[model samples]
Structure formats: structure tokens, C-alpha cells
Target: MTKKGGSKHLKRLAAPAFWPILKKEYRWVTKPSPGPHPLGRCIPLLILVRDMLKLAENAREAKRIIFDGEVLVDSKVRRNFKLPVGLMDVVSIPRIDVHVRIIPHTIKYLWYVGVPKEEVNLKLVRIENKSLIKGNRLQLNLHDGRNILISREESQKYKTLDGLLIEIPSQKIVQHIPLEVNKLAIVMDGRNAGRIGRIIEIQEKPGMSRRKFLVTLEEASGHRFQTILEYVMVIGDDKPIIKVSEGT
Candidate 1:
């Protein structure tokens, strides 16, 4: 048998520094293309299973588990080791009774968090774009690259940046959370990543150089932090719509 000819290794220097791995020791690593998650914000499924989760001893073991239809991402079995899993995405291994969701972290860009059984199918995705299709149907482009189409009338209530709580496998919309003042949000970058708070105020900068709007977040303990609009992801109105717990 012959191996594939394409490059399968990513340069350690070119990889994202925030990734939890020994950067200097390994000269090459897996580089995944744009998939459910963006390139820089996601890690390859192989490294996640082998190195992060310690589920498999090596890449070969990880690939075997995935190919055997034991690894499910977003409720669907994924065999590709290079699949990109990002924030808010759920990972499940029924055989081990283990499930986790990727969440943002201040120190590490993203990290895995344990997800209870009841919350395994729930995921929040932000509306990144909206467009009208040929048959008068409205198309919603999600932050994770998933698309959903509905009637124009049905989509009237949704706007760009709004969050939708969807049930996996079925992809049914269970809740719609709007992006506005007083809504609950989480900082995704720059100083504060996992801090959950309510939106106190939003300031739009029309003529700024590269920065746009700024959002003010007020934590439960009265602490406040300001971040660029793009650095936050709206997750709820009064509180989080799903369960979040740190994994071992």
C-alpha cells in the first residue's frame, strides 16, 4: 500500500501559539482547513482526542476510534482526523459516556468543558449574515458556517449577531436570543474570554480606524470590562441557556 502524497504536517512556528501543546518539541502538526469552525480558532480532532483528552495513545489509535463511528461531533459521526472543532461545538463518545463542549478561555483561546447529558444536544450559534434567496426564503449564515433557510416571514424576527439555541441532529431552533443591551454575553478575546456578564451598553464608532463598536459588560460581582463588539458572543438574555463546567 502507498501513502497519500499531500503534506500532512503543519509547521510548529506557523501554528497558533495559544494551542495547548509542546510547540518546540514537535516540528510538524496537523493543519485543518476551514470547516465547522474557523481555522485559527479551532484545533484538529486528532490532536484533541490524542493529546488533549488523552483518550487515545497516539494518532493511529485516535483515527481508529473515529473511523469506528465512535466519535460524534454536533450529533454526527466524523471520521476525518483533521476536522476542526471550535467554540460551542459539542463532542460526544457514547462508548465512554463522555461529552464535552468547546468554550472560550482567557488564557488559552479555547478549551473543552464537560457537558451534562441533557445539554449535549444544545448549541448556540450566532447569525453572521442574512440574505434573501430565490423563492423569497431567507438564508441565515451562522458563525460556524452552518446555513438555515426559512420563509421570509419566519426570519423577520432574526437579525445579524443574534444567537440561536439549536437542537443537534434535528437542527431545530429551540430559542432565539437577540443581541441588545442588558442581554447576557461572554467575552471571547482580549483580556477577558470566559467572563459571563450582562451587556451594560454598546457604543458604535462610525469613523474609527479599524475598530468599530465597543461593548460594556457588567459581571455579577459588579466588575465591568470593555471589549470590541467582535470580541463578544451573545449567549443569552438573562443568563446562559446551557450548562458550562470545567472538564478534568
Candidate 2:
């Protein structure tokens, strides 16, 4: 995939089948785990897994934890959340991998966590994305340490990519893609883990065809049922509001 863009970037969207969703909601889904992992804040994954980290151990040990089924995204067990998740990605793991911060060379963006002055825009040699963009506050594990949250800033950072100090500019943090696609947030927590259904219709009035999404949720016990539940607006957000989930 090639195009005339501002900078010579790599990759389009991530591979469609790259992620494997869990069949059922894990019991630890609502345990209030930290979010926006450190790997997500620094840069895109292509740059992380390729270079930058100082890895001197056996390569397979690192690969198994990052690539295997240990990572979860948005309450679902995601095997490959590191492939190329952007601002739209939500990540989590079952039992907090306490060995995260000590992994050596993983840059993290932390919300509820602050960052130092010197660690921004650094490429990740073993992770997926590393160039810390803006609006990316992340919590990360760095080598036998507690999970940490840190933020990155804009500055002129130089790295010897091809033996030359490649001067890179500060990154801006702007999230929200497909900006037109309104989010269907889960209002009722703990029920189906907010993975119930998609919006089917929207109405300026009670009954109208103005619905947005038609969703199919994987209910517990592996049943695929159809319903129009998730939507952008609630029953009283506006006059004669359009409601998705019942009793809204």
C-alpha cells in the first residue's frame, strides 16, 4: 500500500485476522486494571519490534510473552494487540504481568503517571509502536517493576538510525479516527461486560429508521444473538431521544 503522504510511513490498517477475541468475557474484565499500555504510547508497533531496545537474551522468550495469548484488548483476550493498535485500541491483561516495567527498553505513556524529560519519541526495538504521539497516556511494565504510567512530550530527539543523528520532531497527540463514527459506550457496566449489541436505528422521534448500527453480541455460553443495543445517544440526551438498550 503506497500513497503520497507527508512522510514515508509503513503499513496500512492492521491485518484483519491479526487479533483473536476471547469466546467469553474473562472473570477479571471489571477488575479496574490500568489502561493504554506503555507500548501503545511511544510509537507505532512496526518501529518497536524492529529496533531500538537493547535485547541481549534469547529472542524467543521475549516473543512468547508479547505475541502469545497473554495480552487482552478491551476486555477481550487479544493475542496480537501489539501488531498495530492506535488510539482506537484498548488493552488489558488477566493477571497484571508484574514483570512488565522491567522488560528493558519498552517506552510507556502513562496517565495517572508522569514522564521524565529525556524519554520521548524513542523507537522500540522489540515492541510494535514506539514514537510517542500526543493524547497517549500509558501504563507500562519495565523489567521486574510495578506497572507504571508516563506521558511523553515534544522535543528534538536525535537517534543514530543509519549512523547519522536522525533528528525527529516532537509528536502531536490527536486521537479519534473515522471521526464520523460515534462511539456506542456501555452505560450499564457488569452486564455482558458491555459487549452486548450494536445500534440498529436512531430516531429523532420514538420510531424512526435513523438508527446507526445493527449489532450481534456473543452472549455467555457461546450464543450469537441479534439485537440493537449500543448507540451514540441515550433516551434523554435530546428531546424525543433515540434509545438503543432497553430501559435507557
lDDT of each: 0.83, 0.27
Runs in model 2 deviating more than 4 A are 1-59, 97-248
Give the best candidate by lDDT: 1
Candidate 2 achieves a global lDDT of 0.27
lDDT of 1 by residue, 1-248 (tens): 88866555689788887776778887887888558776688989988898888999877898999899899999999998899988888999999999989888767778888888998889988888798889979999988888888887888799878889999978789999988899998876677887888999988766863234888899889999888777778877766888643521
TM per candidate = 0.91, 0.21
Root-mean-square deviation per candidate: 3.7, 21.2
lDDT of model 1, residue 140: 92
Q: What lDDT would candidate 1 get against the real structure?
A: 0.83
For residues 13-42, what per-residue lDDT tens digits would candidate 2 score against the true structure? 321211121224232111111234323232
> How good is model 1 by TM-score?
0.91
Strongest candidate by TM-score: 1
Off by over 4 Å in 1: 1-8, 206-211, 245-248
